[model samples]
Target chain A: MIIVKIGGNILDNPERLQAFLLDFAQMPGPKVLVHGGGKIASALGQKLGITPKMVEGRRITDAETLDLVTMVYGGLVNKNVVAKLQALGCNAIGLTGADANIIPAQKRPVREIDYGFAGDVAGPESINADALEFMLEAGLTPVFAPLTHDTKGSMLNTNADTIASVLATALAHKYKVQLVYSFEKKGVLQDAADDASVIPYITAGKYKLLKETGVVNAGMVPKLDNAFAALQQGVAQVLICEGEALPSINTRQYSGTTLSLN
Target chain B: MIIVKIGGNILDNPERLQAFLLDFAQMPGPKVLVHGGGKIASALGQKLGITPKMVEGRRITDAETLDLVTMVYGGLVNKNVVAKLQALGCNAIGLTGADANIIPAQKRPVREIDYGFAGDVAGPESINADALEFMLEAGLTPVFAPLTHDTKGSMLNTNADTIASVLATALAHKYKVQLVYSFEKKGVLQDAADDASVIPYITAGKYKLLKETGVVNAGMVPKLDNAFAALQQGVAQVLICEGEALPSINTRQYSGTTLSLN
Candidate 1:
């Protein structure tokens, strides 16, 4: 099974997203899609007189923002993807972690900062893998929005990357899962300015050396950390690639950064 | 099997919705919930400067309104209900018609009036009864939003009442289906303003006499018509009642207007 995560960049582009969904529909075997909110929420927020509040470059998921993301991520984006996938002959189901109590999380605790309604997944062990497995075995593709629920009746904002990573790690026990983090770039680039400077492969040792040399861009750091974490937690394969390059991943001729344990 | 549909009156009130959900959760056996968008969409639209357009009291679902309903109905209302139901120990899965291609529809054609993205279900036979039965037998309760999708990849604004009726009529073939249309009122009333004048039972003959005598409210005509349509299409029972009275129906002590073929 493959768990693929796409960020706002791909979601905001119609042609690219349609192209990605076509490739995704064609990919053999069972798969799950996790998507980010993109600019739609923020843009809609501004129109509704709710200016977004960001702290340390991370969004504060206040009551209004939680509703905003739930509408955009859970409703608009998720449904659109499912509809498009259905058009491509894939039986897709849109979901939030709350749907089947699939991915229960704790409301992020307040420390130096209050992230408001943001959620933190306890670990891979917390996921309802059985329900997910049932859907997969039923020939359904699950398209998840980046939202989870607390047991106490609240929908919490969650990170899309974390959702994809956690799902991959949890489902690893049942199937050999390949986790893909797809974005606009072709792969993890050695240089920030050049798209052609793609790193073909990175092991733990190589990543450490790249970090020491300061070759990895700041934006790619968190994604790489998540990739490495998912790999450590037993996910069979991890790839950082362009959205259009999804089909190649299935063919094992992927032109992206493939991460593995060393 | 029971298919209960609740409208905006119950949905807009937090206390009423919670109380109704509690009653609904305690009702034994397989059940499905269908909900309507309340004032949230209109309020949100007002904030975003998208003044709603209506013709003959029916809101025109332009592209913007379609997106608005998708957000409010499918996202805000549906997920909150699912989360709340989950908190109450009901394994609720929130869905729109597009999710599993469970309720496919066509865009309303332009006649004298173009309803824009409005959807009309092609009767009960068009519903995916097998998929719905699968969910019900899996111990999952499906909470649906008043939205359907065209096969060509567009989500259409659907009437919650129609969705509920269609579902009940379709599932009646496999189960002893009881269709319930729940709202703020207790039941069909003898007088428009009297709460105590609840009509306990009505048949096709009784409905015609009530219509001729002007005893039935004009607003309730469509609902009664849908109810009768469902019964004609093979639904075992049809009830129009207060959302709070859900549990009473399970025990055969319902204080609602029960409809039947005479």
Candidate 2:
């Protein structure tokens, strides 16, 4: 099973998203698409007079922000993707973790910096695998928004990357799960400034050296960490590629980084 | 099987909706919920500087309005309902017609009045019965937003009452269906001024006479029409009640006007 995740950058571009979804629909297999909230939420928030609050560059999902994400992520972005996919002959059902109690979570507790209504999933065990398996087995692709429920009557903002990884890890028990993180960039670059300097493959040993040498830093660090964690947790493979590279990835003509434990 | 619909008034009031949902969750058996867009969409549209265009007392669902409703109804209202239902121990899955391709519709054809983005269901046959039955049999209650999709790749605004009716009519082939329209009022009233004037039961014969006498006018006319239409289309029973009366209705105490063909 292919469990692909696309970030906000792709979602912010309509043409890019449509092109990506068309490729996703044509991919021959049972798949799940998890999407991130793009600039739409912040844009809508601005119109509503709700300025986003951030701490150390991380978004603080306050009550208003939670509502904003729920509408933009869960509603506008998710439904639009489902509709487009359906048109492409892929049966896609949009979902948030709260739906069918698919992913139960707890509100991020107060620490040095309170994240407000943010949620953290426990692990693969916390996911409702049966619900997902049912959809996939029924020939339906589940498209998820970046939202989970606290099981206490509140919706919580969740990281789309973590959602994708946990889903892959959880479903690995039943299917050969390939987790792909598709973003704006082609792949993890050896030189961040050069788009053509793509690192095609990275073993755990290589990843460690790259991290130690400060070759991969910033957002890519946490993303690769999540990818490696999924590998350790039973996922068959993990890929990081551009949204446009999905067709090539599906055809085995890999154009991006494939992570593995060596 | 029970198919219940709630309008925007109850949705606009949090406490009232919570109480109503608690009652709904406590009710036994397989059920589905269809919800309408309350003032929230228009309110949000106002914030976004998109003024609503209405003709002949009907809101014109232009592109902006469609986006607005998708965000509010599909996103804000629908997901909130699902999360709250989960908190109440009900396994609720939120959906639009676009999700799982359950409800496919055509964009309203332009004639005298072009109701932009509005969709009309092609009767009971157009509904995806198997998909809904699978969810219901799996013990998941579906909560639908007032939206449908054209198979050609666009989400369209639909009426909540129509959605509820079509679902009831379609599912009647598999299960004995009870269609309910729950709003702020107690039931279809004989006297619009008095809450106690709820007509306990209305057969087709009575409905015709009431219409002739102009006893039930305005919105209730179309509601009763839909109710009767649902009854004609294979639904076993229909009820119009207050949102809080679900438990009572479930228990057969009947605190609303039950409709029948007679």
Candidate 3:
């Protein structure tokens, strides 16, 4: 089974999302949805006078910002996605971290550096894999909003990437399924400027060297880290590439960046 | 055991972080860390003429912003925290999501609404909790940056709060620990205008009520969300209170907001 996660951007693009989801539902083992709605949330936040702050690409949620996120990520975005899936003839369940206890988080210690009302993953322990599997078995896709719970019954923010990696690894561990990291890019470029020159594969030793030499820069740094990490552990294989280009990842096939322990 | 996550603002006030780490190291529990550094990241981004885009509180990391985050969250901030921990009588290791396979993630799909270069939690796989537990066993504290991994060998932006929640839950599940959501004010204010009105306990039903009719307001939304998530699953209890109080989450003491399942 290949576990597929569509980004919030994809979800935002109705045409693309509908097309992608339609294709995804037709030929899939278990498809779990992880998404973003930063645009919607931030737009609303700014309109509401909450100064939006961010580090890198992740938003720094303050108390006000967090409220905007819930309305968008949990309320607007989550329900709309579920509705779309239902319209597509797919049985989709909309989940906020609160439902069935999916994502549990910890409150970050306060500091002069206020990230506003943001939170982190204390544990994705609440991910009901059994429920997810059941959805898949029953031909239903679970469209998950990045809303998780903490022990105290509060919902928290989550990174779609972290959740996807967790589910992919967890599901892979549970069943030897392949984890696919789909995006708009072709794959990890040998040279970022040259997207066509994909770095088909890299060994752990080389990965370290690449970092040491500084060829690995910016966001690419962490992506490679997780890719290598998955290989070190046991996750069958991980494929990173543009979603529009292919249906599935097979080492033999001509497509995205593939990472494997082999 | 309790996992104390110092915020990036603590970095702004080195002396404060140093002081907190001194006590945190001495406090009891199997601990892991998750932190943020938006204040520093944004300052540099502005100097570089990058008008850091935020969707909600999250940043949309493009190539340039990513570099800035690496420097702030991964380099200076991470190192500074480590240095402080060392001085505070704690054996602390500084890490980004790239190291030790902690927090693997993936790029969000390109939403029609651009969160700039921002990312959200997709999956939270591959945290080396064994190493964390090993550190806790040896009384070593792990100082973490909020950076996470994409399926590629790239670094994706992750919110600190999300990071803390994930780490708290992960460590708690593995080693059995308590979590504290300390801030600068009274914990979980029943009324935002009145910080002293801390709610010692909350439930799912109560949380919904809080969200309605304006009690849950803005910032506390995600904070409360993540807190509830952790409590629902593995965390023994989650306390939301003032960070300056330090090492004490007692609800009766008016230290911070203490959340319970009851």
Computed on alpha carbons, the lDDT of every model, listed in order, comes to 0.90, 0.93, 0.61
Looking at model 2, the pairs that clash are none
> Ranking under DockQ, best-scoring first?
2, 1, 3
* Stretches of candidate 3 exceeding 4 Å from the true structure: A1-262, B55-58, B116-119, B122-128, B250-254
lDDT of 2 by residue, A135-175 (tens): 99999999999999999899999999999999999999999
lDDT of 3 by residue, A78-178 (tens): 54555455445554555544443344456565665645445566432445565456446655566666655454524466666666666666566577766
lDDT of 1 by residue, A1-262 (tens): 9999998889998998889899998888999999998899989988887888888887798999999998988898888888899889889999999998999999999997899999999999999999899889988899999999997899999999999999999999999999999978899898878999899999989998898889986777888898899999999999999988888885668798899988
Model 3 misses residue A225 by how many Å? 35
- The candidate maximizing TM-score is 2
> What is candidate 1's CA lDDT for residue A20?
88
TM-score per candidate, chains pooled: 0.98, 0.98, 0.49
lDDT of 2 by residue, B1-262 (tens): 8998999879999998999899889878999999998888878888899999989977789998899999999999999999999999999999999999999999999988899999999999999989999999999999999999998889999999999999999999999999989967898888999999999989999999999999989768888898899999899999888887888885668788889999
Candidate 2 residue B2 C-alpha distance from true site, Å: 0.5
* Candidate 1 ranges beyond 4 A from true positions: none
Candidate 2 global TM-score: 0.98
Which of candidates 2 and 3 reaches a greater lDDT? 2
Ranking by lDDT: 2, 1, 3
